[model samples]
Structures are given as structure tokens and as C-alpha cells.
Target: MPVSRTERLLNLLIALLNTRYGLGRGDLREKVYHDTSGNDVAFGRMFERDKNDLRRMGFEVETLTDTGWAEDDSTTTRYRIGKDSNRLPEVQFGPEEWTVLLLASQLWERAALGTAARSAVRKLQSSGSLAAVELPAGVQPRIKPAGQAFDDLVAAMHARHPVAFTYLAGSTGREELRTIEPWGLGSRFGQWYLMGYDRARQAPRHFRLSRFTSAVTTLDKDTYTPPPGFNIREELDTLPELPLRTAVVRVRKGRLLALRRRAADGKGVPPAPAEETDDGGYDTLGLPFRDPEVLAEEIASYGPDAVAVAPGELVAAVRRRLRAAAEFSASPKPRYEFPGAGAGARSTGKGTSEDQLQRMLQLVPFLVHNQGLRIEEVASHFGISRRQLESDLHILICSGLPGGYPDDLLDIQWEDGRVYISQDLDLTRPVRFTVEEASALLTGVETLRGLPGVAGGGALEAVALKLSAAAGEEGRRAAALSGPPVTPVTPAAADMHGTVRDAIAGGRQLRLTYLSPQRDSLTVRDVDPVRLYSQDDVWYFEAYCHLVQGTRNFRLDRVQELEPNGREVSATVPAAGGSPDRLFTPNNGDTTVTVQLTRQGRGLAEDYYAERVAELPDGGMVVDIRFGNTAWLPMFVAQHGGTARILAPDELGDAARHWIADALAKYDG
Candidate 1:
């Protein structure tokens, strides 16, 4: 019978690792393959593939081509894996550094990098010298990778592959096809942007992830190599932020109060007298805008209640979005699936040999350091099933030196409920971190710098230096590939985080001087600290307020001042809800608004925890969202421009129309 692939690979690894002089193709075929490769051609192909696989797993398999210096030399080429290079160097870190490293590991959250970050951490933990450290309660920070698009883009970037997608242009409000050699991805101004070489444009361009009209399609790996020393962080520095400009908008008197307050002066006017329009009295305000698209969206959602009067671009954009939203409201709603309803189409999380090999390489060392662990516990740590772990243990028990003797193989036993690795065949150490592994970790840590009070002051830099030394050249390359460059929280904000962390840890009450934008007021209140976390790089704390007597979320930046109120928290605070994805908690009396999201606005479905009521044919979604108030629905529909419209609840739809109509009536001569 033909030999199993597991046995063949294990045998091949044994032959290569045990060889003093490099083994030639003939010797490898005879000793490792044992004629199971069918023929000479098959043997050669198998050997080449196996060599590449080992190299991909971070094993340095050296190839030496004979130079005909010896008269009796018959071997043309031979291969051998360097033992020292395959084994990881000793890694040591103090408690402070470990605290920061642990913090970095959690940054990826559920993003694709989370897996690599976790694996990298596991390898570090297997070093047998761990210092116990814990990050403070309620001080969790995470990177939000929106959906499948982020995973695909990050994968393509790592592989150096070119990607094709339909991108929606902001300036013209048009969709166009783009082929990009992705250099890096980062967030600026609360949005993710891809910096890449546009193949058609033949120049570098940045594309927003939300504007991608179609799913990203990866072309080929190694399509083009990025320039050496290309730093994603530095490249982002050259790009200018959206320039602020002013827009003249006419508002229905006393209506669109939010928009009016945005540009209001002391007298509630922009030095222009109020005039009566066909609908109601109108007041024109000089509204400052950084992006016409955003401004247009906000105006259009107001329907007839607000209108842009000046800056032809803003006026036209606002009109276009309002018209589209009005039209969509008149159309039939489509069907949509709930978030997890379509999960069957996703991957089953099966591990390939390539994946399994990497895990096992790390697993061996982890088991060496941590002996007598439960089989299930080991499987859980490695992120595999107990059945898969058993299969791996079986394969490992049969792997070792070329002789195939009992002592020649590894001695692994788990028949007694707990697993023990008595013999490891000199594979007791983890391998060096691969480029991809090191890159994900370094990028995560780099992002932590943007978080205030994370990495605990000096620990971040010291850990970074030590990780660079441990990761060596791979770490240097990782430095070139960067994630989003989030602006560091202000020094005051950092101090605020430190104070909030202490309060939450101590279960103390805090007196906060806060500015409430909704109320347009500055007030001081005593709030019992509960949890502190961040979503989208914005820090917020949930606390029970003495005035409101309910838990309310306070944005860190909005706080004018914060000090402990010198009292232990009275109320029994619930454990901080782990994830901060949804900052606003909905009330029972809130209305459930069904809305249709198309193109750019589709992200709102996830942002608001919308239930998939329907799906649209134009690659859009119809969802039902429970908003604390229907008052904000008009702004929501318009802010997404034409991409979102109120689908159900007739009165809410009428509100959108009336708001737009009043705004447009002001534009009439």
C-alpha cells in the first residue's frame, strides 16, 4: 500500500534534520520516500515541494550544489535543514514588558491578524519563562476590521498581490473599476484607506474601504514587490487631511436645530436676516465643511427641512442625494438575511497540512515547556479540536530520525487523560517567527501607541526593542508594513484614561465636568465608574450617574475635567460588557425603524446591530434597527446620502421627505 502523506512528510523532515552532510535526491527518495513517490520525476517534484513547505514553516533548508572539486563526487545537489536556525533563540521579558505584550496581543480582537497575534503570543509563552501580569479591568482597546473586505485586503497586502474592485468615487459620485498593488492599509479621520499603486492610473492612490462597490478580488501573489524601506506610517504623513471650507445652507426657522447650532453665532444668525419662504420662515447660515460629500449627506437627509444655498458643488450633491433617497422610499423593500443566518457559507475552520505543520512546530515546544496538560486543554490553546489534536499526537509519535527505531522517534503519551512529551527529538524549542507572524504583532503594538495609557509608559518601547532583537530581520521588514496610524490621545486624554482606569479598578465614584453636545451644556456630575474601553480609537467610559441614576456612556475627549469623588461605588455595577461595538444602548420604548442601505451605507447594518429584514437587488440590504428615538432617523437617512432610505414606518418616511422639501423650498427664487 502507498504511504500516507503524514508519514511521508514526517519521514522527510526526519531525513533532512538528521543528515550530517546534505542528502541528495537519490538518498532522499530511497530513505525518506522509500519508493512511494512512484518514479524519479515524481520523487523530484515531491522533494522540491517538501523543501518549499519546510521553508514556509520558518525552517531554513540549505541547498548546496556540488562544484565538481572532488573527483569522486556524483551528487549534483543536496538539501539539509539547519538545526540551530530551526530552533528559536531564548526569549526573556520582564513583568512590565509582558503586560504590554499581552495588551498588543488583544489589539487585533476578531480581525484576521488576531489569529496570527495569538499564535505569536503562544510561541512566546512556550519559552518557559513567563512573568505574571494583567492589564487593568475595563481598559480594553481593539481594532475594528469591518468585514470580509478587510481580511481579503490584509491577506493580499501580505502576499504582495494586486487586487481589483469597483470603487465609488467621492468627487463625482461615480463607480469605477480599480486595480491596485496594495502597499498598506491604515485609518485616518475615523476611516480605513488603502494606499496602493493604481495599475490603470499608473500612480499611487488611496481608496476608502467603504467606497468599494464590489468585493476585492486578488490577482496574483508577487505581482509587484513594494520598494524597500516603504513605511506605511510615513507614506500616510504626506497625504493631506480634508480641507475645511464653508457652505451657505438655508434652514427652516427653528427646524434642523442641530444643523443651525453647528453654524450659529451669538444672535442665532450668520449676519443674515431671516426671511419667510413658501413653507416656513428660513434662516441662512454659513456652515463650515471639510468634505462636500459628508456635508451633502447630512443636508439631504433633512429632506425638505434644510437646503444648501451656495457652493454649487454642495448644492448639486445634496440635491442628487435627496432625490435618490426620495425615489428609494417609494420603491418596494428587498429581502435580507440576519447577520449569522448566512454563516453556513463560511469556512469550517479545517486546518491544512501547511497550517497544521506550523501549529505542530509551535505545539512541540509548548508541550515541552508545559508537560502533563490535558489533551483537550492543549487542543484549546492551539485552536484545534481534540480529535485533530489526537491525530497530531499520533503523527508526532511516529516522527523522528531516519532509522525508524522506537527511540529514534518522539515519545509522546496521552493514554492517561493528560498529555506528556517525554522525548522531543531535539524539537523542544519553537521556530523563529515568520514574516507574516512578526508583522501582525509589530503592527498591533504600533497601534497601541495611539491608545492613551496602554503599554504602560516605558514598557512599550522596551518591549518593541526586545521584540526587534528576537524577531531580527523579519521584525525590520514588519516595521516597513504598517497598520492604521491613529493619532495619539492628547496628553490630557492619557491622564484621563489613567484616572478612569484607577477609578474602575478601585470601584470608586468620579466627579466629571462634561460637555454634552446633545444638550448643548457643560455640567458637573458624580458618576460611579464601571468600564473603560475603545471602539474606532475613541475612548468611552460607562458609568452610573448620580443625576441620571442610570448607566450612561461618556466620551473621554468630551470630558472637561475628571476627579474621584472620594466615595466607594454604591451601586453593584454589572461586569463591563466585553465588546464596545455598539456604544448606544437602545431603550424599550424606542421605535424599530426598517431602513434600506445601498453601496456606501451598507456598513450601517452592522454598526447599528440592524436585523436583516430584507436584501435589495442592487447589492444593498434592508434592515430593522431600534433607535432610541425616531428624531435622528431623518439625519441617518440623509447622512448616508442616497445610500440609505427609510423603508418601513410611513410617518418616518414622510418626515424624511418633509425635511428635504422644506430645505429645497428655501433655494427657490
Candidate 2:
């Protein structure tokens, strides 16, 4: 018999044991060799090899003594797992959970270890615990093939080989053949990216796997060396294509504030209102401010309020697109005829409208007060179809407000067709930011509130308010307060922060407008944004700057422009390992410190330190902190004066002493 036949016999034995609760030797032989009656002919060296294979594959087939299969009364010859050998835990499955499991298992089919997931399913089938569970036929999921390139790429990644391929740039439709030293694979925002070192550029880059045309793996493994001082996270944020020149156009009233907020905070903000300029023109916006075409639809939505404020070429592009849209909408819309309908509006069946409304009303009492309820149960209770229930829900979301929103009495959180409701909502309580929270909000908003493909000021403010209310009274109050006045020059520090955060989270590179005091010069550099931190009331981007050829800190206030670089970054760039200590360069010779922070500054320390607490004697906190760069400490001490002191790094102590002496000398003068 072939090896496949022998494997099937073992599977057959397990299945028979599960079905009969225990199988006799006669039954096992009959099932294993259906052609032979009462005959065990397949017992040879080949059979021993099959048994050994089964053992190697984690099965516990062994001799048992309880069945009385042996001639002697005291001995029995049977094969089964020993009672103590069942190390696998029993798991019970439900219909829905089982369906999900089956769907997830399909993902393994595309992987190199596809056989393992199938084996797992086979074992589950043999386990009597899952015997009663049946997944419905309608729940069968549609499986899409993962394409040849993705499979080949994944295999190459696992094999640790260099792959040369023609990669399609999704945005450009351009193909380039390049060799890459693969590092890792990650999925972000519904797209797959292959991280590796690009031999052509000799830098770390990430390529979208879906865009690769043809790829072949070479036998060479680990031949590539990542560029020295390269950081992958930093490289991700500084893609060249991602750094577009973004222009934010705020609306009337808090428009400038919103624009500043959007510029300062870089996560996407809600779309700006459609604006009409004095000349009946419109303003357009997008992230990285590089491509206006991507946000053409958004600009069109504003009707006319949107204005282009930067990069003359982008403004012209928006105008040209607007002209094209104007010409397109000028064409008449085509109409379709139904099978039996005349030109007039369709009529509802007799008495159907009242019945539908009554059914919807029945759902209101339960749905209005509850956060969530099952769609299936609700559909059954109301004698309604799923389609009808969904249509009613759409109407309900817009129904409650006295006029529109604030007075709206209800809201819904629809998840997988399940409805969650928030009732008796007060609209007048617009999302408010507290002084400190507003400070943080303004900090976040200034950078992010205006970009396309992101949430804007109005949306952010509402979300912030919702979060604040959920956080309780103190948070609400704290959010209500505003921060002290300090003017950051054009484009604002807040905008830089938002862009950097977006770039990091989006896995795109960043191009920053940096200003150095050496000369009043604006330098554009690509960087991977790794992390953001604030010290002494100032925000800075700790990114791997391609210009400096290393990781460096760039002050938010000094940044001129921050945009997403959509191009691939090298994945072979070594990650900035260790801790935040990596931020301090060797030439700087910065050190970590332990500090006693007064009650006020303790909160500040808590924000930065993972481990921070107040010690009793002085009502201050003992905090361990890393000052990657020491120059900022004196300014920090001066700003939050009386509440903070340097607790460690005796070198910092000497610096403080010198600073105090300088101050005393001024008094002597």
C-alpha cells in the first residue's frame, strides 16, 4: 500500500473510535481494508514506518489493555491514546464562532504552512466534542486567491533570500526592476507592504506587495548590510512622494483656528466646507500637499469655499480639474425605465406603510435606551426582513434632532448590522476642550485639522468633546480651559506634529521644511518619523533624517513644512534599537537621570515616564527620565520653576551650578 493509504487508515481508526465511542480490532481491520473481510494483511516493515510517521506527527497511538482483545485474560493488544496522554485541551464551538474559525483558516491556505492548518481541522473533526456542531452552508466564505507575486514574495521572505522583481508603484503605474533584501511583512490600512533594503538606492524602503509584477528569489541569503545609523521607523515617515505641499483653508469664524489646528495636527481632519471665492473659484487640499488630483473630489465638494494657498502649480491643477468637472456635470443624466412602472413615482401597497411604521416604533423603545442589540433578534421580534430593518435604521439616524443635530434625541453605532443607540442627546454641548486639554487639542489640531483624507476641526472637536464627556467631570472641566498665548511662526509647530504623527502611523516617509539658525535657510529632508516627545513645553520629532544621515531631533516650531512621502522606504534600515536613549547621539554624551518632581511637575513627569510616583517626604515624585539632549533642561527648569529639580546625572548638576553662578553674577553687576 502507498503512504497515502496508510495515513488514511490511521485517520479512519480515529474516526471509528470517535463514532463508536471505542472500536474493536475487528472493526478497525474492516474499516482499514474494506476489500478484506476479517483479515489483517497489511502488517509489515512498511506499516512500522507509517506508525512512526504518525508518532512524529504528534499522534498518541499506543497499546491498550482494557478491551480483552488478547488470548490471555491479563493482557490486551489494542491501539489507542493512553488516557493520560491526552494533553490537548477540549474546546467547544458555537455556530458563528465555528464559521469565523473556518474563514480565518482559509488564510493559511496561501501560506507556506498551508498543510498545518488543514491537519488542525482534521484533528478537530476526529474530536467527538465538535461532532454536534455544524456550520451552515450559506456561511461559506468566498476565498480570493492571493496572486502569484504575493505568494512568491512570502516564500522568499521565509527563505531569507534576495528577490529581484519589477515593482509597480501603485500611484504612478511605473515599474522598476530592483533587488531587495527582505526584512519583514506587515499589513497597514488594508494594503500589504514588503519591508526590505533597496539595492538600487542603498537605503531602507517598503514596497507594496500587490504592485509587484514578477519576482524571483535568489539563493543568496543575508548578503545585504543595512546602512549604518538607518532607522526603519524613521524611514517609513519620510517617503519622498508623501511630502506634498499642503494648504489648509479654514472657513468663516474659527476658520483660521481650524486651519492652524489642521496644520498643527496631522491626522486627517474632517473635510473643510465647500467654499466659493469672490471670483466664484474653489479651494482644494490634500495631505503631503504634493498631489491635488487625489483630493479633487474633496475640493469639488466645497463647491467654492476651498482655496489653494501653497504651491502655485497645485492651485492651477485644482482649477483645471474644477473646469473639467464643470464641463462633465453639464451633461444630462441618463434615466432608466422599470419593467412595469409608468413615469410617475411608485406607490406603497395598501396598509403596508402603517405596518412598517408600527414595526419600526416597536424597535424604538428597546433601541433608543440600549447601546447595542442583535440584528437577527430584532428582525425576528419585529416581523421584518433584514433589508427593511436596515432601511429603517438609516432613517432613524437622521430622524431625532429637533432641527438637525444637537437636539437630535438619538444616535446609532452600527457594527456588523448590530445596532447600538445613544438617546436623549443634548446637541448644545458641542465638543469642548479644557485649558490643558485645549492646549493638547490645539497642539494636536494645529498640526492636523485641515488635511484631506483625514478628520478636520469640526469632527475632531466633536470627537474630543465626546471623549471628554465619557472621561467624566474633571476631564470635561480640564478640556474647557485654554492654553497660554505663544505665537509660533507661519505653518505652526502644531502642523508639524500632526504631519509627523500621520506619517509614522501611516508607514509613509516624511519630508520636512526645517530651519536651522546657521543661516536663515529652508532645507527639505526626507526622514522616517519614529516618535514624538515634548520637553520643556516644546514638541520635537525624533526621526531618522536622511539629510543628516542619522537620527536627529527637529523642533516643531522650527519646521517649515511637513508632508507625507508616499514612495517606498528601505526596510533594511536598522531599527533605532535600545530605548529612547538612541535619541541622544554620542557627540552629545547625554545621560539618563532620576528626578524628584514637585506635585505640579509630577503630572508632567507622569506623562513622559512609564514609572513615576510621588514620594511622601516632599510630596514630590521620584521619576526616572532620559534627557537625550541636556541643553533643554535649564529652559525646562526655568519654565516650570519651583516644582522641578535635576535629581541625577551629576554632570547636569554641574551645569546647573554654573547656570546659577551666572545668574548670581548678574545680580552682583
Candidate 3:
């Protein structure tokens, strides 16, 4: 039988790696490609593609053009895979550095970075340089989740590909198509920003993640490499802050409380009776803002309860948004990527041959270092099933040097139930960093520098330095990845993160000073922590609230104080009914409200977890959204300004109309 492509590639890798003088094209054709290719043109094409594939996999394939095979022709290039250049240079890490590195790797719990961080950590572990004890109590931290756009940008950047997206510019408040050569992505002040050379503008520009109106897409792979010695941070710093502007607003009493919290100096036009509202009273306040569009969205969410009193531009913005919202007719809506949608979806697929080959390359060195590990343990480490592991192992057993001999092929056996690699075929060390792997670790480590109360910060810096040196170009791609403040990394809420995580791990109860948005009040409560997770970049922890005597999800941002209450488990609440994936699920008590949503309001279906959604021909959506507390429905309707309308339960629509009438009344006066 003709040699399998995988075997041929392996033979090529072994031949190139073991060579000292660099193998010429003629030699590779004769030794590695003997059974695979006969035609000279075909062999040359295969050799070139394979060489490029090796480079993409992070191997340093050096070419010497001057040294040809026959003394007659000096132009034929000789290729050699330099072991020293491809492999990670030896490094010593104290336990503390390893702990910090572990924490850094844990930053991206979901999306692209999460996979990257995990794989990166495994590679580092294979190096035998990771000597880490479990992080001490009160030391664990978590990363805020990134959106789909963030994930796509990191992927495109690592692949050295250009990307295109529909971006809603903050300045113009207009959605436009933008194609860019992405350089770096990072957070400046609790918001994610992408720094890239805009192809349309032919200049470097920074775009925010929230402003992404559509999905990010990659253009062509290897479109153009970043300029040499480019730094992601240096590029990010060039983005200037948005100019500060303020808007004065009149708010009806007991309404628009969140807006009240952002008031300037707590002293404004003061309380006054209003003829425009059904409300008996109103408060006039001055609100400071940066972007008009953002402010308009916020004000519109209040419906007519809050109105712009001054600044003709601010008034115009609010009027325009409300008009657009009102004018938006219901059409079809795109689906949302809800958390944990499919059941047992992760275990079904066996990967392609190319994917398996890549994993085996990493698996060899890992097995070599971590000997006698259970088959299940190995499968878990590589994120595969036992059957797939067996398949890979059997294939590995058949792989070796070009020659077919007992000694030439690898010696691997699992019949005894404990895997042992008698021979690794010189694949005893992890292969060099794939761009994705290097970028993940680099981005995670950089995010560590921003985390508050993290010990061994210098160790993190040192780890980043080593990764950058080893990863080279891949490291720069990682530097381009950034995110908002993970939870409360500031001084005050720093320790609370570890405390919550520690409580969950140690099974201890917690005391919290949490601000509830619905109740519009702060309360001290004791609770048994269940789990911690994030969505849309916000952190939340499910805990059994003692004050309410029920399980509740608390927003980490609104948490003022959190500490262990010195109480043990009450055993009243089970962790789960088979440990479900989502933190919260819709209960029977939630009321279904039918709403007409325009294209701008489609996000609401996802936010509220619509029970059912039907697309409208006009690019709008009719969704049956669930809400436990319909009291906030009016505000929800108002926030979309007018893009959302209550189609059923006539009472909610009346409430929203009244709220808007009250706010619009301010401008009338």
C-alpha cells in the first residue's frame, strides 16, 4: 500500500529533525517520499506544502539555499528542522511562578482563550518546569468571559489574517463595514478595544468590542504579517480617550434610579412637580457622559421617565433614537449563543486525521514525561474520549521511521491498561508552539498584570517574557488580545473574588453586602455559595441567599462586601439535578410576554432567554420572552428606546407609555 499522508509527514519530520547538514530536495524525495510520490513535479509540490505546514505548526524549518545536493546546482534549497530553535528553551520556575502562571492561564474560562490557556498549560507541564502546589486559600481568581467578536479577533490575529466586521462607530452612531489588519486587542478602562490598521482609512484605528454590530470574519490566511518589533500595548496607548460631555436630565420620582446614581455632585435642578408626567413629583439632575450614542441608549431605556433638558445635540440624539426604535418594524432575528444549549454535545465528534496527528505530536512528549497515567486520565488531559485515545495510540504504534521494522516503528502498548511509551521516535519533547497555543498563554499572562491582589506579579512578568521569547511572532499576536476588568480587580473587591472561589471550593458559607437592582436596595445576606461563572463579560455567582431563604444569582459587580460567615453546609440545597450547565434556568413562575422586536432589539431575546422566537420578513422578530418580574418590563421596553413594543398583556404597554409621557413632559416644559 502507498504510505499514508500522516506517515509520510512523520517520516519527513523525523528525517528533517535528525539531519545535521540539512536534507536536500533530492534526498527528501528519495528517503521520505519514496513510496508517496514518483513524479518530480508532484514531489516538489508536496515537499513545499509540507514544509510550510511544519512552519505553521510552530516548528522552525531553516532553509539553506547556498548548500545544494549535487555540486552542479547550488540553487536547490536544503531544509532542516532545528531542534534547538523549535523547542522551548530550558527555564527554571519556582513554585510561586507556576502558581501565578496557573492563575493566569485560568483567566479565560470560556471561548478561544480558554482552550488556548489549557493547551498552553499542558505544554508547559510537559516541560517539567511547572512545579506548583494547589494555590493557597483566598488566592484563587477568575477571568471575565469574552464575546464572540473577541474570540474571532484573537483567532484572526494569530493566523496573521485580515478581518472584516460591521462596526457601529461611537462618533457617528452609524453602522459601517470595516476591514482591518488586526494588530492588538486589550482593555483600557473596563472595555475591550481592538487596535488595527483600517484598510478603508489606511490608518491605524481602535474599535471597541461592544460597537461590533455583526460577527467578525477572517479574510485570507497569511494576508500580511504585522510590522516587525510591533508592541500591542504601545499601539493600544495611541487611542485617545473620548471627549467628556454632560447632559442635564429631569427624572420622575422613584423612576430612573440607575441614572440617578450617575448624577453629577448629587446637587442639580432639585425636586419639582411636573405637568408632563402622571408622576406627582420629579427630580432634575446633571449627568456627565462621554459618548452621545451611549447616553442616548441609556436615556431611551428609561422611556419618557428621563428627558434631556438642555444641550440641543443630546436632545436630538434621544429623539432620533426613540424615533428609530419606534419606527423599527418587527422582522426576523438571528439566534443567540445561549449558555449550555446542547446536552452531551461535547462527547460526540471524533476529529479529522490532521487534527489527530497534531494531538499525537503533543501526546508523545506528554506521555513520555507523565508515565503510567491511567488511560482515562490521559484522555481527559487531551480533551478526548478513551476510544479516540485508543485509536490515536494504535495509529501511533504504526508510525515510525521510513523503514517498516519492529525497531523502526514506535513501541507503545496499552493492553495492560497502563500506557507506556517504550519508544517515542525522537518525539520525546513537545513540538514548538502553534500560533494559537502561544497567543493564548501570552494573552492570559498579560491579563494577569491587570488583576488585583495577585501574588508573584513579577513572576507573571518573567513568564510573559519567556513566552514572548519562545513564541516570537505568535507571542506578538497574543499581545493583541485584551479584555475588560475581570470582575472587580480594583483594591476594594480584589480579595472578594478569592474569598468567593475559596468558599465554593472549601464548602463554606458566605456573608455578602450585595446591591439588588430590582429591589433598588442594598442588603446584608448569608448564603452557601454554589458556583461562579461569567456571561457577556459580567461575573455572577449562584448562592443560596439566607435572607430570602432561596437560591439566587448575585452580580459580582454590585457586590460591596463578601466574607465567610463561619457557617457549615445546611445541606438544604443540592448542587444540582445532575449538575446542569447554566447557572439559572427559567422556572414556571416566569411569565411569558409577547414582544415585537426590530433588528436593534433582537439582543433582548438572548438577554431574556425567549421561550419562542419567530422571524419576520422585514428583518425583525416576534419573541415570547420570559420575565419573573414584569415590573422592569416597562424599563426594558424604554431602554430599547422604542425599538421594542409590548404586543401582549396590554397593562405593560400602558405602563411604558406613561413612563415615556412623563420623561417627554420635561422637554415640553
Candidate 4:
């Protein structure tokens, strides 16, 4: 059986740690890496690689040289890890601090951040310095960006490698091959962007990861050095501001409330001359937008609720796009080809490189202070496998100050499982946080501050203080300038969240009176709560429902009553699968409901049901959609008024008619 890299490294570490005297190359090959024992050169190379890996992970391998000490009177060299330098100091965290860290870890419970957070939590748990605390429910803020481009770009940026990808240009709507030296990665307005030096353009440019038409492939490492004093945050800050244009639009009364609130909150340009329509059902308002095309798309998405009154070009653009969509749906053959079909290639780089780099920077100082620790203890402290630890150490041993001199390099030693750093190039302290990192932390803390459990707590305040201190003057100023405020949780919902979270943690079942929005009725359920998550401001409890005999997501706000049952949850629940988009996906055995939508309802088909559109010759659209449950279909049709009507499934049409009639009866009453 072939031994895996991780297994071999683990075996090597175990052998070294168990032995009092470090084993020589011959002994190591025979005792640990027996697979390579036949080839002396291969064994030597593997041993060297393993030693470098250990050094990279901040392990100090001490070498003992003795001549005439052996029976053969030959100079023999023995290796051992210095137990003094490899251990991390025992650090105590206060309850508030622990809570803050816990909240921080929870905030990053999805993407790349989640991986680091898990490792950190593991390390903390293994140390037994801080007791584990239950995190608050409805406080998890996960950032899961689509595609592997972001991950690959981040790796290239860290490794100083050039990356090549096919990017769909926003200006031309054309796919073009781009080779760039990735300098930094950042997120703005929930979109990830890669800032890099475009090789073709010979200029710095920013590429939105979503626009990538192909997988990112990392080229040679150290392709080009970043210019001195190249600060990604500063570059982002210096980006030119987009010019805003005023747009006059008419919106339906009580509709577009979110937009009005955003404008009121000073998040966008103020609207002026907002006049009520004669029918008392519409309002005319002037809104400002940076991109007329983007604004047009937004207005189009609102269906008949919003319409562009002025700016003929914007109006024409929206109409043109809608007409094109309608025409495309009507065609049996392909009228237009999609731009990003080449995105099927696998991404070359891994996501964990950036996180590893950050950890390595912190590791230097940790090893410098602690000095001597056992290999296993060091690996556990860092929450890494022995192989990974060795790989990291290897990288560190070859890394040093800019001079590249022997004395300038890091002097790391590991012998007989113990490790130490004998000579350090003054790399004892961690590098200062970049602007993006500080901003991200501030954003995370601000988000956590709105959660019921974290709000009004000293933990957030303490965390904020530390973040501000680390951010320095510029970062502090950036953080001080607040973005949008977090949506506050309802008191009832907050209480339910606590109840469900506790039940899930304690392995107890829950009794809940849940208000079914679709059925417009209340139903009591016995649930074995599994996971608690939140999207935007809405909290959901993913539970194994005893009533349904399957997992279901219960909206916390819709839960009328929640009580923890004394019975322990005995049945094991399967893990939650699929993306966030899965919530909107129809079940396999769902009924296909067809609907004919008028031109005014074109936006609905264009935006929400893009995959279901079949165009009619008269500028209307027929949408064939699958619904897991048709309970909410009536209300959805009624909301669109006469613009949409069910064409198939007579039962659905009858239900929609009944819903409209019920509403009319209420008005009559």
C-alpha cells in the first residue's frame, strides 16, 4: 500500500518524537519512510523536503555533530526538535474576549474565512486555555461568493504568481483573455474584485470575479515583484468615483418601499418633487443613479410597479432589453450565444494559501516567544497536520529578510520531535493588518453588534477597540465612516432563536407552533433542530421535523411559539446540503404550472423566472415553472394583479381567482 504524504509525514514526526536521539538519514529511511528505502537519492530528497516543511511551520530542528563518537570513527549527525522554542505560550482569554472571538469565528462560517476560523477554534480547544462557549443563534454572517476565481486569485496574489483567465469585459460585453499579476483581493458591495497589474494593458486594473469567463490558472511563482509601498487599500481608495445622473420614475403606491427607505437613510441621492398620482395608487419620484443601464435593469425588475418617466435613452434601453428577452424566448433555435461558456475548466490554485500565509506570519512570533515544543504539540497548537506543519516549516527555513544572505535567513531547527528557532531575523512580531483586513473585521463586528446576544455587550466594544487600534489612523477613519446599518431582529424572533439554538446544542427536541405563510394557518410541530442560520435579516432553523419525517427550514419570525421538549433527540439528522439558492429550487416531483404574462409583467419573467420563459408573438411571455408546493402560487398571482394569469393546471387558476375574490370581498365589507 502506498503511504499518503500526510501519513508519511505523521510517521516521520512520531518516529522522531519517540526517539531520545535524532535518527540519521539511513535510520529514518528504514524505520519511517520504508517505501523510499531502496532509492538513497529519493530518500535524501524526501528527508530534506520534510525538514524544510517542518522549518516552514516554525519547528526548530537541532543538529548534533559528533566525530569519533561512533564505532566506525566517522562524523555522525543527529537531528532533534528543540522542545523549548516550538511551544506557544499559554494565553488566557476573558469571557468577553472569548465571546468576541466566538462571534468572529461564527461570522466567517462559510467561505475561506470559515476554514481559518475552524483551525483557530481547534487550536484553542486543544490548548484548553479557554473554555468553549455557545455562540448566539441568528448571528452567523456567512459570505459565500460564487465561483473558484476568487480563491485562485487570492492564492496567486500571495504567491506572487501571474494568473491567466478569460474575462468578460463589461464595456464591450466581449470575452477576452487576460494575464495579470494579482496584487490584492477585496470585496465591495457584496461583490469580490481582484486588483492586479494587467500584463496586456501594462496598467493596474480591477476585475470582478463574477465576470470571469474561464477558470483562473496560476502561472510561474514570483513572476514579478510588487512595487515598493504598493498598498492595495490605498489603491482601492484612490479609485475614481462614478458620476451620478438623475432619473425621473413613477412607482406604485406602497411598492418600492425598500428603495424609499434606502434613499431616506442617505444611502443614495435624495428624491425630489415626489407627487401622488390622480388614481392615488402611484407616486412620481426623481432618483439618482451612477449607471443608467444598471438603473434601467433595476426598474425593469420591479415589473409594473416602477417605470421610467424621463430620460428617453434609459427607457428605450430597458424596453430594448425586454423585447430582446421576449424575442429570444420565442425562438426555437438559439438567437444569441451566452458569453461565459468557457468557465467549465477547473481552477488551478487552492483557496487556503492566503490564510496559510497569514498564519505563517503569526507563527514566527509565536515560535520566537515559546522557543521549545514537541512536534505533535506544535502541530496541535497550529491546528495543522504534521505534514502540513512540515511543509510550512520548509517554506519558512528558505524564507528570510530581503538581503537573501545566509545570516539574514531564518535559522530554524527541529530534532527528535522537539523544535526551536535559534537565530531569528527580528521577525518576532506579526505584520500590521492591511486596510482590507481591518475593514473586514470592523464590518464583521458591526454586523455582530446588531445581533440580540452581542448587542449592548462589552465584547463587541472590546473587539471594536482592538480593531481600531490595529487599523491605525487611516483604517480607523475608514471604519469610522459607517456603511449601511444592519437590520434589527424582532423581539419575538430573537426569543425563538435562543430557544431553538439551546435545544439544538443540548440535543433536545423542540415543540413549535409555526405560522405557515403559504397555508395561511398555524401548525404545531415536533422538531429536532439541527442547524440555525440567517440570510440577510431572516433567521431560519433547519430541523428534522417529526411531523414531516424529513428536514425542513422554519422561519424564526413565523414561529408563533417555541418550547423545548424534555425528550432527547435520538435520531441522527443528515447534514444540510446545497447552496443558498437551493431554498428557491423546486422539488423533483413538483407540479409544472404554466402562466401567460402580459407585457407589463415582462420584468417578472425576465428577472425571477429567467429559466422558465417561453415568448408569445404579441410581446407577452408564457412561463412554465415547477413549484414544490402550490400554496403560495395564488397569492403570487394576485400580487401581480391582471398582468399575470395561470394558463395551465385549472386548480391553480381557480385558487388565484378565489384569492382575488376574497380580497375584493374584504374591501366590500
Cα RMSD, each candidate: 6.6, 29.8, 7.0, 14.5
Deviation of model 4 at 650, angstroms: 22
Model 4: which ten-residue window has the lowest total lDDT?
342-351
Question: Between prediction 1 and prediction 4, which has the larger lDDT?
Answer: 1
Worst 10 residues of 3 by lDDT: 341-350
Off by over 4 Å in 3: 1-12, 18-48, 62-80, 136-146, 166-179, 199-202, 238-240, 247-288, 292-354, 450-453, 476-508, 518-524, 530-542, 547-551, 560-566, 569-669
Each prediction's TM-score versus the true structure:
0.72, 0.28, 0.72, 0.48
Better of 2 and 3 by lDDT: 3
lDDT of 1 by residue, 105-127 (tens): 76676545777888788889887
lDDT of each: 0.72, 0.44, 0.68, 0.58
Q: What's the number of clashes in each of the models?
A: 17, 79, 16, 38
Candidate 3 residues 482-601, lDDT tens each? 544454544554466667777877779999887676676779999988766554245677888888887788878688788887987578966532223233566678887878776545
Error of 2 at 323 (Å): 66
* Candidate 1: residue 21 lDDT (0-100): 83
- Predict model 1's lDDT versus the native: 0.72
Best by lDDT: 1
Off by over 4 Å in 4: 1-5, 16-23, 44-88, 129-137, 168-176, 201-203, 220-241, 245-669
Worst 10 residues of 2 by lDDT: 427-436
